[model samples]
Target: MRRYLLQDTAQGIFFVTISNLTKEDSGKYWCAVSTKLSIGNLFDEVSLTVVDDKTLATMFISAC
Candidate 1:
């Protein structure tokens, strides 16, 4: 399976896709933007949680 894919929406918007998510995939991820030599790089981080179908359903139910 394709693990990673980077896409540009043709409108200055970008997306990153990770396929076949698993428990191992749950971790911190970073999105980096490079700037000109005069400026440093920009980075944003997000935490991901990979849960099974049952767990996801339970979470949804509990939220209601």
Candidate 2:
């Protein structure tokens, strides 16, 4: 699982980014803050859906 912690100083935005999305990656995700001693709790769960698509031309090309 790839996780990211990025802060945009220009926009003043705080959020996390997930990369390398896959079908199994589709699930409930959330964010939390914590210290080195202990982990934080879960809050504001969000659902993510990943769709896999193939074009007809690509499919036909591969079949050839």
Cand. 2 Cα-lDDT: 0.44
**TM-scores of the models, in the order given:** 0.66, 0.45
Clash tally, candidates in order: 0, 0
Q: Best by lDDT, which number?
A: 1
> Where does candidate 1 stray beyond 4 Å?
37-39, 53-64
Local accuracy of candidate 2 as per-residue lDDT tens digits, 1-64: 4244455444423545555556776777654443354544434556767685221110001110
- lDDT per prediction? 0.57, 0.44
- What TM-score does candidate 1 reach? 0.66
What tens-digit string does per-residue lDDT give for candidate 1 at 1-64? 5566777665645766666677877778776767675767866776778885212211101110
The number of the candidate with the highest TM-score is 1
